[model samples]
Target chain A: MPGYPPAALLLEDSMKTALRKKLLRDMLFARRFEEQCYQDYQVRKIGGFLHLYPGQEACAHGVMAAARPGEDYVITGYRDHVHALVCGVPAKEVMAELYGKATGSSGGFGGSMHIFDASKHFMGGYALVGGPFPLAAGLAKALKMQGRDEIAICFLGDAANNQGTFHETLNMASVWELPVLFICENNLYGIGTSIERSTAELDQYKRVAAYRIPAAQADGQDIEVVHEAAQIAVNHVREKGTPYFLELKTYRFRGHSMSDGGAYRSKEEVEEWRKKDPLEILLARMIEDGEITREEYDAWDEEILSEIEDEIVPFAENSPDPDPADLTRYVLVEDDPYVHGGPSKGGA
Target chain B: MPVMNIIQAVNSALDGALAADEDVFVFGEDVGRFGGVFRATDGLQAKHGENRVFDTPLSEAGIIGTAIGMAIYGLKPVPEIQFSDFIYPAFDQIVNEMAKFRYRSGGQYPCGVTVRTPFGGGIRGGHYHSQSPEAYFAHTAGLKVVVPSDPYTAKGLLLTAIDDPDPVIFLEPKRIYRAARAEVPEEPYRLPFAAAVDREGEHVSIITYGAVLHEAREAADLLAENDISAEIIDVRSLVPLDEETILASVRKTGRVVIVHEAARTCGYGAELAALIAEKALMHLEAPILRVTGYDTPFPYTLEQQYLPDALKIFEACETTVDF
Candidate 1:
C-alpha cells in the first residue's frame, strides 16, 4: 500500500499518477461499500442506525490520504465506516461490526456508530454529536506527553460546532498547543437543519480563529483539493506542534441515518449537491487528465462491488453472534476481580 | 506510619502514583501552582514538575474528556473536578464515554481514569460546594465508585483507584479532609473496593460510606453506651459493593440501618436496602431503616439539619433495633 505521500507531493502539478489512481480507487471502494450498507440495511442484514458516507467520501479519503495510518490517531462522529476503512480497518471487519457479529471490529458491541480499531490507531466512531472533541484533544495531549510526532485528527459535521464541548475542547487544544487537526466536513446541513438555519456564522473555519488556531477551508468535492488542504493542515499541526482547523465544503447523498427519509431537504437541493458528487469529480478529473479510460474506471468499480458482495457480505453473514454468557466481558479488564464476580467474601 | 489528614493522605497517594509510574498524570482546576483549593494536591507540582502535575481550564467536560483521551492512550490520568458538585458539566464524558470505552471497544481500550473529587456536606459550604453525588456515579455501570472515609483509606484506596484497570470515580470525603486524621503508611499501598467492618457488634448493623461513616461510628458509640451493640460497616466502595460483609452483619444483627449524606429518594442507601430485602430478607427481624439527607436540595444554614448526623443515625439504629 502507498503510505500517505508528503504535503509537497500532493500539489496538483507534482501529484503522482499512481497516487491519484489509488485515491480514486479508495474513494470508489468507500462509495460502493456505503451503497452496499444502504442495501443491507433495507434487506435487514445490518441492524441499528446506519449512517452512510456516499457523497462526502472525499472528505474522509482525502484527509486520511495525508495521514499515516496505524500511527496517527483518527476519530470521528457516527458516520464512520469510510473513516475506519481509510485508517486500514478491514472492510470485512467494518461490515461485520454493522452486522453485529462476533468477528466485528468492536466484537459486535459498537454496532455502526462505534467502529474502533486500536491497532490501526482509529480511535473510534462516537455516537454523540460533540463527544469526540475533547477526546481528540486528549489523544493529541497523549502524543505530546509521550514525545511522539503523531497528530490526532478529529472529524465532525458543521453543526457540532454549536456544542459546548466543541468550544471548550478547541480552546483547550489551542491553549495546550496540542497536535490535532479538527476537520469539519461542512455538509451544509446537520441532519435536516441547514447551516444557515442553525449556525450564526456559516463559515466553520472562521470560528476556529476565536481559539487563535490557524485554519483553512477547501472544496471537499474534489479529492485533489481536499488532499492538498489536508496535507497543509496536517503538516502545520505536525511541524508546529499546535492545533489546526480544516473545514471541507461537502454534502452527504443520504440522510443522517437509515431511518431518515430526508423530507427536510428539497429534491432540487439534493440534486444540485449530487451534481458535485466527490466520486464523480475524482473519476472525471482522472479521465479528463488522460490518466484512465471510462472502461477502466467501470471495470474497477465492478471489482470493488464484487469484493463487497462476495467477501465482505458473506464474511459478516457467516460470522457468529456475540455469546450471551460473555455479555459482561468488557465491563472491566479481563483480569479484574469485579469482572468475574462482585466483591470478595468479607470486608477488605 | 505517619499521622495525616485526608488532604495530606490524598496528596501522598498522588505523589506516590506520579513517582512510581512515568505515565501517571495529575491535572484539574487549581491543582497546579495553587496546589488545589483544598490543598489535596499541595506542593505536588513543585515536587513532580509542572508537566506531571498541572492545572487545566475551568471546563469540567474538557478536563474529564481530555483525561479520558489520555487514559485511552495508555496514560494513568487522575483528574480532579475541584468539587463533585461541579462534575455535572462532565457527566457525559464520565457516564457515556469513559464508562463505556472498554465495553464499547470490546476491551481494546480500557480507560483507566481515576477521577478524584471532593464530595459530601459540612464545613458550611452550601449547595454547589458540598453535594454527595456518589449515588449518581454508583448508578453508572462500568465505573467503580469509591469513597474513602478517613486518612488511611483515602491514601490506600486512591492508590488502588489509580492502579485499577478500569475507570474509577474516587469521591473524597471533603468533610473529613482535615478533621479526620490517622497514621497512614508511608509507602504506597492498595486498598480493595470492599466494605470494612469498622466496629463489629450484634444487635444492629449500620451500613454507611464516605464522611457519613464517622457519624455511624459516633452512633455506634452511643449504641454501645445503651448496650445495643451496633455493627458499623464502612462501605468504602459503593459500586463493587461488599455485599457479603453487609449481608453477614445484617444476618448476625437481624436489624439494619443504612446511612448516607446524599438525599434519600434513590440514594445508595436504597440500593443497600433493596439488596438486603432481595437476598437476606429472611435473616432480618426488623424493617431496614435509612438515615439520609432529606429529598430536597442541599440547604445552606440548614446544612446541619439536612445532613444525617450521629444523633439521626443513633435514632435510626434505635428504631431498627426496637422494631
Candidate 2:
C-alpha cells in the first residue's frame, strides 16, 4: 500500500473518535431503515422493485461523504436507498416516498428506485441499466458550462459497465473534459449475472480506461478505503475538468430486489462476503482502538433502531396517498405549453 | 412576413430559442460544424458558439440521455436525432427515461427535452433514411408529439416545443425540407397544436398530417376540377390531437379519407379513422377510407410505389365519395 494513499486521508486524525461514532450511527440508520422497509414489502406496505441496502453502508457513507451537500450531484441506478439517505433526504420523506405518499420526495410518485431531491443535488435513482451514464456526463457538462466547480458522481452497477451508455458517455466526458466521476459499486453480481459471466474484464474501472480517463479501485466495504478513493477521484475530476472511473469493490447482503430469490450465487459466497460486513468492520475496529466504548456504540445502535421503529415507520404508514384528481399532476409543469392553439385538454 | 422553406424555418426556430434562452442548447451527429446533413441546424454553431451548439458522437442514446440529464439539471436541451430511422437506439431513453421523468418523479423533476428528428418517405433514402414513426411517440403517454408539415408551422412549432415545459417529439418531415417557400413571420410566434383545415369542400374530409399534407392538398385540387369539393385537415400535433376540428370537418363533409406516409398497419391514420367512427359516425355519408404507405419495410428501388402520392389520396377520396 506504498503508492496507495492512507485509508483515513479524508477524515482528520484528531477527529477520529468523533468520526468513528458518527460513521457507526450513519450506517446504523441505513440498516434499521432498510430492515423495516424489507418487512414493509412483506406486508405490502411497500411495493414495486424493493431493493434494500443493508450491508453496503460504507459505500454510501464513504463515497457520498466526498460529495458537497448542495454543490456536487449524485446519481445512481436502482438499489439506491442509502445513497439518498446519506445525501441528507430526511428519513421521513424517504420512507413516505416508499409508502407512496404525496408528502414523500417526488410527491410519492417515484418509489424506491426513483428517489429525487433536486435541492440536495441527489438527482434521482435512474431505473434503467446504464441510462444515467450519459445523464451524468450531461450534468457535468452543465456544471462546466455554467462555470461551477461542482462535479457529478454517477453510481453504476458491475453489470452496467457493459452497457453502451457507459462507453459512449465515458468517451464523451473524456473528449470534452467534463467534470464527472463514474463510480462502480461492484457488488459482484447484477441480479443473477455475475461479473465473470458478464464482463470480459473483472475490473470494471479498466473497461472505461479505454477513454483515457484515469481509473482506481477501493475496498467498498471499508469506509476508510472507499472515502480515500472517492476523495482522490472527486479531486481529479474537479482539477482536470474531466471524468475519472472508480470501482468500489463491495457486495450486497440482500437479494437484488424483494422478489429475487438470489439463486445465482451459493449461500457460501454470501456468507463469505457477510464476514466483511461494513458495519461490523468499523464497529469492531473502533472499539478495539479505543475510538469509542462498547457502551457508546450500543447506545447509538439503540437510538437508530428506536428512530426507525418508532418514528420513520409510523410516518410512512400514516402518510396520506395522493388525491385521485391530482393523479394527472406532474405530467407537465404549471404552464400548459400546448395550450396556445392545441386541443383544450392534453392527453395524459 | 419573410419567405422561408421548412429548412430555413427550422433553423430560424433553433436560432431564436438559442438567442433568447441561455439554457437552450442543440447537439447531434454532424450537427455542429457540418450544419447537419439536412442543414436543419446550419449556421447555428457559428452563431451560438460551440457550447450552445455542438456535435455529439453518432450514438442516439448518448445524445438523448445526456440531453435528459441536462434538462433535469436546469437546461433546455434540443437534441437532434439526425434521422428518425436512427432513433430506435435512443428509444428507451426518449420513450421511457425522458418521457417518464416527470410522471415517475411525481413532478419534482420535469425534463424539458425537445428531440428533433427528420422522418418521412419520398426521398428515396430507402429503409434506413425514410421512415415515419410518429405513431410510436404518439402512443406513448406523457409525451407531446409534433409533426410540422410546412415552413410556417415548422418554425412556429419548433420554437414552441423548445419552450414547452415537458418532453416534445418534434418530428420534421424530411421530404419537405425544401419543398416550397411560405410566408413566415420574422419574429417568433407560436402555432396552435390543433389541426388546421387547409382546404374546404363538401364531398369528403381528408384527414392527414406531416408530408402527406402536400399530397392531400394536390389531391383536393384534382377533386375540385372533377366537381367534388374536398376538405383537408392537417393534424399538427399527434398526441394533443385536434379531435374537434377533425370531427367537425367529418360531420360537415359527410365522407372521410385518411392519409399518411407511414405504414398502413397501426399508423396515425388508423387512429384518426377510429376517432371519426366513434365520434362522427352518425354524420358520415360514407365509410372512412385510408391512403397510406405499404406495410412492408420502406423499399430501396421501388421507393416511388412504396410512398403515398396525391393520386392515392384522390383515389381514396373517390371511393369514400362514391360509397
Candidate 3:
C-alpha cells in the first residue's frame, strides 16, 4: 500500500472534517440510489441499459465540488447517475427518469442513457463513447466566446482514453486555449477487460501533456484527494483558459452492471477493494474527527432509508407510465408543441 | 446591379450577410486564407479577420457539430463542407442533432445554423467529390433545404438561408460555379422558399433545380425550334418544394419532366414526380418524364455518361412530347 496514497493522511485538516462529512453523505446517497435502481430493475420498474455510478461516486463528488454551479458545465458518458445527482439534478427526477415516467427528466424519452439538465449545467449523459469530448470542447469554445470565466468538465472512462475523438478534441481545445477539464475515470477496466490488456499507455495522464495541456493524476476513490486535484485543475483551466486533464485512478465495486456475473475478477480482489471503499474511508474520517456520533450516523441511515421508501419507492410506483401516444413526443417537436411534464418548459 | 458568376454571387451574398448582421460567422476547411476551393469565401477572411471568417480542421463532423454548439450559443454559423460527398461524415450530426434540436428539446434548443456545400457531377472529380446529396437532407424534417440554379437566386437564397429560423442545408452547384453569369442585386433581399416560377410556355413544364436547371433551359430552347413551347420551373427550395408554382405549371402545360443530377431512385425528382402525379393527374396530357443519373454508384471512367446532361433532358422531353 506504500505506492497507494493514504485516505485520512491525504486530506487537509479543513477538508478532512467538513468536506469529508459532505462527501460521506453524497456517497451514501449515490449508493442508495444505485441500490434502488437494482431493485427497480428486478421488479421491471426500470428498463434499458442502466449503468450504476456506485464505485465512481468520489470522482463525481470531487469534480462537482470544485466547479461553480450554473457557471461550469458537466458532460459525462452513460455511467452518469452520480454525476447528474452530484451536479444537483434532483434525486426524485433521476429515479423517475429510470422508471420511464412522464415526470422523469427528458420526459422519460432519454431514460438512463441520455439524462440532461441544462439549468443544472449537467450537459448530458451521452451514450456514445468519447462523443462528449468534442461536444465539451464546443461548449468551452462557446463559453470562451461569450467571455465567461467558466470551464466545461468532460468525463470519460479509461477505455475511452484511446478513442480518436479524445485526442482530436484535446488537441483542438489546447490549440484554442479553450477552458475545459478532460477527466479520465480510470476504473482499471472497460467492462471485464483490463486497461493494460487493452491500451499500451497505462499512464493516461501523460497523453494530454503531448498537447502541451497541464495534466495530473488523482486517487479517484478518496474525495479529499480528488477535490484538491480537481481544484488545481479547475483553477488552471480558469486562469489559463486552457484544457486540463486529470486521470482519476479508481475501481468499480459492481460487475459493470446487473447483467455481468462476478466471473471476470476474483472475489478476493473485489474484497480487497471493498475494504478501501470510498464510502467507508470518508465515514471513518468523519467519525474519527467527531463530526457525527454513531447515533447520528444510525439516524442518518434511517432517514435515507425512509426517504427512499416514502419518496423514491412511491414515486416509482405511482408515477404514470409514459403515454403510448406520447412516445413520438420527445423524438421531435410536433405541431402541438411537445411539452414535457412535471418541470418548467425549459427541460430542467 | 453587377453581373456575377455563381461563385461571386455566393461571395457577395456572404459578405453582405456578415455586414448586415454581426452574428454571422463562416468556418470550414480552406475557408479562410485559402478562400475555399471554389472561391466562394474569397477575400471574406481578409475582411472579417480569422475570428468571423475562419478555417476548421478537416473534419466535416467537427465543422457541423461545432457549428451546432455555436448556434446554440446564439451565433449564426454558416459552415461549409468542402464537397457534398464529404458531407456524409457529418450526416449524423446534421440529421440527428442539428435538424432535430428545435423539435427534440421541445423548442428549448433551436440550432439556427446553415450548411453550404457544393454538390452535383458535371465535374471530372469522381465518386468522392461529385455527388448531389440534396435528397438525403430533404428527407429529414426540421431542415430547410435549398439548391439555387442561377446567380441571382443563389445570392437571394443564401441570404435567406443565413437569416432563416431553422437550420438550412444550402447545396450549391459546384459544376456551375463560374459556368453562368447574371446580374445580382447589391441590396439584401430574400427570395421566399417555395416561390420560384418561370413563365415561358403552355406546351410542356420542365421542372428542375441546381445544375440541371441550365440544361432544362437549353432543352426548352431546342424544343422551341420544333414548335414545342416548354415552361421551365426552378425548384429553388427542395424541402419545401414550390408546390404552388409546380402545380400551376403542370396545370398549364398538361405534361411534365422532372430532372435532377442525383440518382433516378428516391431522388428529389421522385418526390416532385410523385406530387405531380398525385395533385395534377387529370391535368396531364402525357406521361411524366424523369431524367436522372443511373441507380448504380457514381463511377470514375464513365463520368460523363453518369451525369445528366442536355441530351438526357432532351431525350426525356421527347418522350413526354410523344405521349
- The prediction achieving the highest lDDT against the true structure is 1
Candidate 3 on A180-261: residue-level lDDT in tens? 9998998887655566555777878877778988788888887777887787789889998888898888888887656556
The candidate 3 chain B region of ten consecutive residues with least summed lDDT is B295-304
Q: Name the candidate, 2 or 3, with the larger TM-score value.
A: 2
The TM-score obtained by model 1 is 0.55
**Of the native A-B interface contacts, what share survives in model 1?**
0.00
Assess every candidate by TM-score.
Answer: 0.55, 0.55, 0.52
- Reference contacts recovered by each candidate, as fractions? 0.00, 0.00, 0.00
DockQ metric, candidate 2: 0.02
Determine which window of 10 residues in candidate 1 chain A has minimal summed lDDT.
Answer: A339-348
Error of 1 at B184 (Å): 63
Interface RMSD of each: 17.5, 17.6, 20.8
Q: Give the alpha carbon lDDT tens digit for every residue of A1-348 in model 2.
A: 122356456445323566667777888888888998998889988765578887678887887776675568989987778888888889899999888787788776677777889988999886566778999999999999999999999887887775677778988999999999988888987664466644578877767657888888888988877777877888888888888888888998998777567666799999999999998988888878778777887887888888888998898889887664443344356455421111111112
- How many steric clashes between backbone atoms does each model show? 0, 3, 1
Query: lDDT per prediction?
Result: 0.85, 0.81, 0.79
True-vs-predicted CA distance for residue A1, candidate 3, Å: 23
Q: What lDDT tens digits, residue by residue, belong to model 2 across residues B92-175?
A: 998889989999999999889999999986654445567888899999998999999899999988888998889999999987
Give one digit per residue, the lDDT tens place, for model 3 in B1-323: 79999999999999998888989999886687667767799899889888899866545677799999999888899999878887876989999999999898899888999999998876544445577788889999999999888899899999999988789999999888899799998888788877566547878888888888888888888888888888888889987777989999999989888888777767887798789889999998887877777654443324456566777777767777777
Candidate 1, residues B1-323, lDDT tens digits: the string is 78999999999999999999999999986687667767788889999998999866546787899999999999999999878887887999999999999999999999999999998877544445678898888899999999999999999999999999899999999878899999999899999999989998989998888898888898889889999998989989998998999999988999988888887767888899899999999998888887877665554334566688898888877777776
Give the per-residue Cα lDDT of candidate 3 at A342.
14
- Residues A44-73, model 1: lDDT tens digits: 887546789999999998898888977899
